[model samples]
Target: MPLKLYKKRYEDIIHSDLIDRKKNLKLIQLMMDMESAFSIPMIKNEAWNERNKDVIQFFQQVSNSRRL
Candidate 1:
């Protein structure tokens, strides 16, 4: 569903005349980067695994510090 939405938005950008070629290319790259970041394998390995516990704890500490 999300991929469908992304594809639709990508097609719209490709067809739009409002943005210049260079900027359009940059936007497309950004979208691809976002897609890669949210891919299932990356999420499962980097986010859901116990190997990243320290990383998660560090972020939690930073968040808690900001709340104080």
Candidate 2:
């Protein structure tokens, strides 16, 4: 399913501050693999400490662009 967004929600942007550039990219790759390959495990795993503000921000930016 696609994501949903509201208007002028900069809180979405702020949640996505500059952090975890590389690991976030990795997360994206993992998601893609799960979508395309379907071999990925659950979103929450045993060692899933994936937290990054930049990843959040980048996703918000992409979603915001789509909204526009």
Candidate 3:
């Protein structure tokens, strides 16, 4: 999916009341951790690395905001 659409869906999930906040936060944290793991230099690919970086940064911001 396109980044813009993915972001929209992410925001929807964030705002939705269907899931427990703690669970959602944990999921986000897991996503960020997974992204971080993929970023290791030994296996990183240039083509999609920037996109992964963007996703990791986005998740970090979301996680921080949710904590506050």
Candidate 4:
């Protein structure tokens, strides 16, 4: 079933499926692998978009500070 197909509330899953924490971890890993293999790189040509600017700057500042 698609993740969207789950009809349970978020709390329901937290209380029930969370019992299988290892399985949830594996699902998350699988999603990451699939996304990296299939996703296209966004050129992000709209550098002036305010939210994008914030995100880009945040990462840039993080990297620069980490190097120090």
lDDT tens per residue, model 4, 1-68: 32332223222433555445544554444444433543313444453334445444433332332211
Q: Could you tell me how far off, in angstroms, the CA of residue 27 lies in candidate 4 after the best superposition?
A: 0.3
TM-score of 1: 0.36
**lDDT of candidate 4 at residue 40, scale 0 to 100:** 16
Q: lDDT for each of the candidates?
A: 0.46, 0.39, 0.57, 0.38
Q: Residues 1-68, candidate 2, lDDT per residue (tens digit)?
A: 22232212333433555355643554454345434442223453433224433334444454344321
Which parts of model 1 are misplaced by more than 4 Å? Answer: 21-26, 29-33, 36-68
Clashes of 4: 0
| Tens-digit per-residue lDDT, 1-68, candidate 1 | 34445445555654567546554564556445544654423334654536545444433332332212
Error of 3 at 34 (Å): 10
Model 3: per-residue Cα lDDT over 1-68, one tens digit each:
44464466566766767557664675565555545555534354665656577764664555564543
What are the per-model numbers of colliding residue pairs? 0, 1, 0, 0
Q: Where does candidate 4 clash, by residue pair?
A: none
Q: Which stretches in model 4 have alpha-carbon errors above 4 Å?
A: 1-19, 40-68
Using lDDT as the measure, the top candidate is 3
Name the 10 consecutive residues with the lowest summed lDDT in model 3: 33-42
TM-score of 4: 0.31
